[model samples]
Target chain A: MLPVIEAGTGPFTQPPTINPAVTADWLVAFLQDEMRARRSVAKAVIGLSGGVDSAVTAFLCARALGPENVHAIRMPYKHSSPASLADAQLVTDALGIHQHTVEITGAVDGYLQLEPEADARRRGNVMARVRMVVLFDQSAKYAALPVGTGNKTERLLGYFTWHADDTPPINPIGDLYKSQVWELARYLGVPRELIEKAPSADLEADQTDESDLGITYARADAILSHMLEGYSNEQLAERGFTEHDVRLVRRRLDGTHWKRHLPTTAMLTNTAINEFYLRPVDF
Target chain B: MEPPVNLDHRAAPLRVAIVQSKPRKGRYEENLRELGEVFAQLTAAQPAPDLVILPEAALTGYFLEGAVYELALDARRFAADLARTWHEAAGGATVDIACGFFENAGGTYYNSAVYVEVEHGKHCVRHVHRKMFLPTYGVFDEERFLSRGRRLQTFETRFGTMALLICEDVWHAIMPTIAAVKGARVLIVPSAAPGRGIEEDDELGSIARWREILHATAAEHGVYLLYAGLAGFEGGKGMTGSSRVVGPRGRTIVQAPALGAHIVRATLDMREIDLARATLPLLGDLGAVLPDLLLDEELPLPRGLHASGH
Candidate 1:
């Protein structure tokens, strides 16, 4: 089935999500601010999943602070392969950050339904939220901040669960697209193999971002850039874009627009109807 | 090993006097006069004190002006005179006096204590200890005027192997631990602590309550911990007079009435220390786990003399 987009629908007309390039000196600074802004933040907490995002965020925090300041928690569910766990250990040992492991299979199974289960999306949200809860628990114990891992592409399409990826005090790569993250990772001296690995949510078996999205990251970046630059939908389609793809992208651009803003507040007084605007500092 | 000191095997309760009062600020003469009255009161009692403990900086209140001008002690002469007066009042009776005073020795001023024995209207001052730990935070400015003490002395008296420490001396783990390890049955602490700055939520009601936790240190280390603190306001600051007595088992056996200039006493058994240490052997485990910075031969001084700043 093909998705459709109505005319005059897109996130461009609304308020922007966080743009790290404008507000932050670097990705590390952004992440640090996020972590320390919370009352419960002790220090920086990382989960070295042997994935590029986690590894990159961990390294950035470690550099911004010190190796001692960065604490890592590795949570491996039942189906997590031995290789992934080994890779996680390798990354943590290499980074020299404090690390602890929690095998979560028993907990996960105890909660599983005996009947037919929910879809992958719901299950993924559950896993993400579970991991977040664990991160928060560990963070409280050490007085550390949980570092989140959700890139720009996932954020734009609302691919992440609201409370899961957003659970961290700091998100180092939240502003950069998947491809730009790749570029930054190379610049940051990340191991080439980890960076080259196909981007996966690792929530389900054999799930890859490119395969699920039905488009390459390079193509998605070009389209996003064009959309962000105020290029019309007609212009995007004219620039070697498919009819169904353009409509699908535009529908996504409209449907997830609410993710880009603070929730609505009711106007209560005179000059209060479109009169009260919140200051950034107040929030 | 045979018992080292000759003490009464049959325990006799002795009156313990704690001069829980601060010295008058910058008025050494007035403070000495006030101390004279306290001494007179203690001596006039039906059963006079077997021992009297005075607070750290008892003669000269927490002196701040000395650090600025480099003249800390004008009270040593006054302290000597006061000692003579107290000796005369005691009427040739041997009274073990832990008198805290500002000691000016070899052109260096120190916050010190003197254990004097009053005999025949003359004084025989024997054991002397300067404060080892000099606090440099909050309200305290000990390091500004006074130099750190290099010794932890345990004096043999008519009582027992009575170990002595000044205010901040008891805060460090090793100081009291070493004193206990060296077979001190009684730990005497003379403190000049000001108690006015306690906030509403400050965990303990007063700083004295926090200091009282030293009872646990005494219990764990198997020693009797006694605190004698200043009571009145001095230099516009409220001095804490919550003096206390703890047994070898870390229990508050007796606590003096809070914020008052008074004397209190308790009967202690020296044998209880060995019994407690035998039951709960925490000190042995701590000894094995902790590195002895004082015992490092590569370092400058010998074991007891090495603790300069804590």
Candidate 2:
């Protein structure tokens, strides 16, 4: 079986080595290759939530696409903490990328007036989707791709909003863990204060990811790594994870499996759109 | 309603029966006896079937990977014998026989399907298709003993252009599509699908999805689909045996009961396929609308990217 990405014929003739470690130079070359092929000016549009993951993703996109091509947007609602705005601007200033601040409090309020029966959870999701709407609007204006900031931890747990904070043209940070994101962020010169701040969804006051998941990032990462490595249930239990914890993670993984899928449609032909087993990529 | 006329172009509907049978505990003779009994019962009916299909690995149960070398035989002998006997029983009814066989040639074993046709005092195997796609994941270990077939072939049967596929071969989307594209009116799939757990849904969504995918493939390529699966316990694993026949409209026209060994028959209207394809125009429009990632003979990794609606 052949590999997914075909090698290029250029001064850099050798194919890039794929591994767990991601390098700044490799990202630059990959972006250059995709941009040249697409024949569009490379640019990044980020939804800056003042979270470490977004901060790290924005910085990486800036380096690859150039700070001039990188654009950051801060979408704040009425309930958003002032510190989130300050931290978002701070990171943008440090990276020297053009920044835009969009207040979505009115948008949310106007939407609610039309449909006030919207519950809290629905309201929060609407805000995230609205923020993405604005970012994608910027993408159209600049012919840029909306760069995703979701980390591996968030993805595994299905923490990010679908088609909102999660949807992007490219996802450089998606494969990295939350713990690993901090390491890469520090390496890429992200502001230490932003990196050090406790992560929050900022949908409601003091709502941390750990609160909803019922486990800290440290514990979630360890169990997730074990699962990814195909460790048996007995092996995980012997290694100190309780059955409840393991089952919870498994159930969460299964429940959120749809997040990893495209919308299911009825297949009416021999070649199904969802039949990925016969995929050409060498595995 | 206008006065009806029998058009010469209107071919008679072919009666195809998928014998979803339970093979006796590695006892090849007993399994053959069970099949003979079922065939007798099916053919004795008022409107007898034109063709009968058995599951892949039907002669021998879903034996473990190592069991293939231990149990596989020169299937040509058994298939030839069965065809001769069945044709004699049909009393010149001209029934075609298709069944799973263990093909051993030059000391290499293959899980294969053999189609035997006995015409005018001459008995011969019409087509032999080696199971091409082998399942290596989870409970399946087909790749261990069977050599993967390199080509997809079709035969012009009395019914229509018939394509033969053993279990995993249907899982290979490209091969089946290619076979259908090459003018196979009815695609026959012989499978040994493991039975669903007690807690599982009665309909078995996965099996239904498999049917949907196969039916869609058939509809897209203007063909009918016949799937015959094993039933009851085979080796330590339970065989589901919910084999079905899906028409071009993506509906299950005939399906065997959940766990029993039985033969289900359905009349296939092959002519409707050309009309369906003509009306829908999916096949003609497909090449113009497929995504760039999906244009080549290989599937794309569906990484949640936009399809871009090509």
DockQ of all candidate complexes: 0.01, 0.01
TM-score attained by model 1? 0.46
Give candidate 1's error at residue B199 in angstroms. 5.2
lDDT string for model 1 (B155-263, tens) is 7766677788887788787788888766677888888776653554743356745455677678788777878776677656777666777767787666665566666
Give the alpha carbon lDDT tens digit for every residue of A1-283 in model 2: 1011111213111112223235555655666655545646578788888888888878777777788988898999999999999998888999899888889998888888888888878988999898988889988887888878888878888887887877776677777777777777777778888888778899998888888888777667767765764554555665577787777777776678778666777877778755732564222
Residues A1-283 of candidate 1: C-alpha lDDT, one tens digit per residue: 1111111224322223334334334765655555555443547877667678777787788776677888888888776656667766766777788989977666556566642377767767767777888888988888777778777877876667777776675577787777677776666667777788887777778877788777677667667755764555775665466666667666777788777554666777765534565355415
Of the native A-B interface contacts, what share survives in model 1? 0.00
Q: Which pairs of residues collide in candidate 1?
A: A34-A169, A35-A169, A42-A143, A42-A144, A43-A144, A43-A145, B21-B231
Q: Pick the candidate with the highest TM-score.
A: 2
